[model samples]
Target: MADFDLEALSLSELKKMQKDVAKAISTYQDRQKAEARAKLESLARDLGYSLAELVGTATKITRAPAAAKYRHPENAAVTWSGRGRKPQWFVDALAAGNTASDLAIG
Candidate 1:
């Protein structure tokens, strides 16, 4: 591994370096996964079984539909599923003295 003097790099140079490192890591990970898949396929062939037969084929991920849980009173378009972080509109409304239940969808 080449030694890098991080302290000598300017802020912009450091950001560029960070992006480059991230991209390199992503590329390396993808290559490693492909190689692993190839090796597994080869082994499966030798064992008289297709890769899909050995490891079941990929299944479609099914998630229950997210229903609107909260909506902006002023704008119907602004709504939240209430699953993750509260949206900015919801926070603002709450700060403006509106309770969470007030925004609940029927």
Candidate 2:
């Protein structure tokens, strides 16, 4: 362990040291976790089963991007899926007395 002269360090130096120490701690923790995981995986393999088989790997279910439900009146390329917050152009069209159905794609 390297001895740091805390009393001799300036305010900026102390802050930099604090940040370095925090980063080092985080890096050390990540390394430890990786090592532990590797050990567990090796032990699991030795027991005649893979880590995923023993732990039950999570299957990520992701939805495909929503089809464009509305198209820009002026710019045909600009479109929205009618999901989440309304876009600025859509809001403007609505403000100009255009109905949602009017802006909707065929």
Candidate 3:
């Protein structure tokens, strides 16, 4: 590392150097982690297994969106799958004494 003449540096120069040092320190861990990941991936490839396969941390399997189970009383386009939270229209319909079976798509 080059020796910094701290006493010779002006206030602005010292502040700039401090900022640069802080940035370098902050990114050092990220750089190290990337390098380690690359090495691990290479080793896993040579061993005939992917890193995810070995670690069992593969991407999650997502299901297709649920089929619409309920339809809006007035709007055919507005529908709900009946899986998550009820929609405002559905809530209003229920409050208006409309049973859930009344909105069934069938």
lDDT of 3 by residue, 1-106 (tens): 7987799999999999999999999899899999999999999999999999988885789999999999999999999999989899999999999999999999
Q: Per model, state how many residue pairs clash.
A: 0, 0, 0
Candidates 1 and 2: which is better by lDDT?
2
lDDT of 3 at 1: 75
List TM-scores for all candidates, in order: 0.54, 0.73, 0.65
Question: Which candidate ranks first by TM-score, i.e. highest?
Answer: 2
Q: Mind giving the per-residue lDDT tens digits that candidate 1 earns over 33-75?
A: 9999999999999999999998899999999979989999899
Candidate number that wins on TM-score, 1 or 3? 3
- Across residues 1-106, which tens digit of lDDT does each residue of candidate 2 receive? 8898899999999999899989999999999999999999999989999999988989999989999999998999999999999999999999999999999999
Question: Can you tell me which runs of candidate 2 are displaced by over 4 Å?
Answer: 1-5, 75-77
Q: Clashing residue pairs in candidate 1, if any?
A: none
Locate the minimum summed-lDDT window of 10 residues in model 3: 52-61
- Among all windows of 10 consecutive residues in model 2, the one with the lowest summed lDDT is 1-10
Q: Give the residue spans of candidate 3 off by over 4 A.
A: 1-23, 45-53
For model 2, name the residue pairs that clash: none
lDDT of candidate 3 at residue 84, scale 0 to 100: 81
